[model samples]
Target: MGALLNQTCYLCSNTKNSIVFVENGIDIVRCSNCGHVFSTYEQEEHYEGYWDDDSSYDLGWWDHAHREIYQDFIKRFLTAPSGKILDVGCGLGFLLSEFKIKNPVGKPRVTKYPKKRFNLPGIKTD
Candidate 1:
């Protein structure tokens, strides 16, 4: 069997050595070179769980009222008639979906390259 490659520190970008810091069933790797810290190999998958946690207010919490407020904010400063908007840190396309709902005729787009669950109706993953 091939040897398991250890994950390097995301901050320092070092691969020589690492120190593990385990907390709440998660392992964080700290690099000796720059003293940078990051999670282990399954870091991405691990943090994804935090995003969907019940205690956390993520995409599911965005209701019609929140959409109305967001729309109002957009209309107040933005002059364009909602044409081809891109949400940078789009969590689960809820905001994009809300925007589309508010302006049915307007063009709505989203980027979900990292997260597969966020790819849904009215959202573009590119």
Candidate 2:
């Protein structure tokens, strides 16, 4: 847990927010102005390969059922899911691999957003 600070909604920068839910002691608040949902605690940068650490195995991540549910949602919502789909914050490239399998017509490239926003894959310019 990190130090709690006065957090304004990043989307609307609105201070008017109320706690909607609390997960792992972090308050998830919803901005009254733009209806943006975010956490109260700031994200602490852990060491490299931090997310891969399953020290808290009870959390039960990497659940294929959840992934399938999301894929089904994508299939239902996004019709033209062709071409390349960018998987920003693609931890361990699991979702990207799944995308490659699900949407073989599309290419998925994983990259960390903002800082290293553009890592263009090798494409035939011709």
Candidate 3:
């Protein structure tokens, strides 16, 4: 096992942690207090792996693939009128786009730093 990070757990802020596994060079650790599993790999501000030289990033395939599940989740849990929604690690914002279509007036606010810009129209990232 690689060296376990001395960082505190993001969920419970506990200093005690155990190495779960390592994937592709990143250490996946589990918090002793909250049992929340996360990677210790620090990501760059602007990740370019999703946006390569080809047009794969602009294919819009993820939207179609995840449409049914996103719709179901929206219908089931998002019935409440006064509630805040936060989509973390929201790659390509497909779920957010679906939510906007379902709730035209309500806008999903972005909390995490955008790894890539949203190509989908109508959904505002601000």
Best by TM-score: 3
lDDT value, residue 32 of candidate 2: 91
- Against the true structure, candidate 2 reaches a TM-score of 0.37
TM-scores, all candidates, are 0.34, 0.37, 0.44
Candidate 1 to truth, TM: 0.34
Alpha-carbon local distance difference test for all models: 0.47, 0.51, 0.58
Residue-level lDDT tens digits of model 3 in 81-120: 7544656463655676665432222113332212234444
Residue pairs in clash, model 3: none
Model 1 lDDT tens row, 34-98: 77676554424544544433444544455544777767766775657755554545354445553
RMSD of each: 10.7, 10.1, 7.3
lDDT of 2 by residue, 1-126 (tens): 433454687545679987888778888888999997877875444334453334454323664546787677567755575644544342544444435333221112212221122222322111
Candidate 1 lDDT trough over 10 residues, lowest sum: 101-110
**lDDT of residue 106 for candidate 2:** 17
Global local distance difference test of model 2: 0.51
Q: Name the top lDDT candidate.
A: 3
Collision pairs in model 1: none
